[model samples]
Target: GPRSESGALDAQPWSAAAVAEATSAGRPVLVNLTADWCVTCKINERAALSSPRVAQAVKQANAVYLVGDWTRRDDAITRELQAHGRSGVPLYLVYRPGRAEPDILPQLLTEGVVIDALKP
Candidate 1:
């Protein structure tokens, strides 16, 4: 697992294969699909995802944090967005162990929101 300079969990590049592997192994997974130019994404990152409480919750849950960058054209990311009936960035998804479908989180977030989502 990667750690940010602030010691929070650093998100890895998103990949369908990695997501599948984590889920199959019964690990919790958090996927953040964002773009460099998305203001809302940046806000959410600072307000929630970057919080120490969220980081601790993730670490306690042993969840993998994966980020999909949509600043550039990415066919895989586009397909993933389409799969969830979304056509843009700022998509947040939480995959719990043994779940077939992920829980889609709101575009806006708070530290409590992320911490609650990671709860078993």
Candidate 2:
């Protein structure tokens, strides 16, 4: 796991505890599945994530930020991707707590889109 500026993507050993807890507490989990080698990933960093709206939502929603770093070759991540039916970077998955399905955000996100996800 790599270090994230926010809690969700913070340094980790890939513990689902946070996600489970959030879901248990009636909150959705927004996950940023990104890769260092991806240029679009970098763009997302500057465009969507860096926006004030995004930062505010991070704190307002107290959403757990989880980051899947595809910069390297990790078997677990690879397996997770395969399970999710994808074999690439920039996969965004938002799991609404208690819902049977998760809302998969697009490969390219903006401040408005991210904020909308925070809404119930």
Candidate 3:
């Protein structure tokens, strides 16, 4: 949950509506579907999303970063997971500018993976 000029992974809470708005405006958007108890999510955050290189990439891309916490049973989050054909946490999705669909990332992440996703 670090704060910086770059789009930090935990900088803001997730909002499905905001994702739609930003994408509609032609901006890249990153969404992390995490849970408090999910070990993979934490690992990905520390290894990739929180890395300096990835953060810079996000800033350079002018992307909107959002984190969805599913600590407890939340209907909206459940639906979102279902929509993506997922049944668990640590889902990573990138909605690039002008794209109708988001690019789904691996459960495990890397700095290069995130940086590449921010490419113009």
lDDT winner among the candidates?
1
Could you give candidate 3's per-residue lDDT for residues 34-97 as a string of tens digits? 8879998888887788787887888889888988888895778889888999998988899976
Would you give me the overall lDDT of model 2? Answer: 0.70
The TM-score that candidate 1 achieves is 0.92
Which pairs clash in model 3?
none
The parts of candidate 1 lying over 4 Å away from their true place are: 1-7
Count residue pairs with overlapping backbones in model 2.
3
TM-score for each of the candidates: 0.92, 0.80, 0.89
Give the clashing residue pairs of candidate 1, or none.
none
Q: Put down candidate 2 lDDT per residue, 31-77, tens digits, no spaces.
A: 77777788987788678876777767766776666676778867767
Q: In what order do the candidates fall by TM-score, top score first?
A: 1, 3, 2
Local accuracy of candidate 1 as per-residue lDDT tens digits, 1-120: 334412466678898988999888988999999887989988888778888888899999999999888899589999999999999988999998788899999989988888899999
Rank order (by lDDT, best first): 1, 3, 2
Give the Cα error of residue 88 in candidate 1, in Å.
0.3
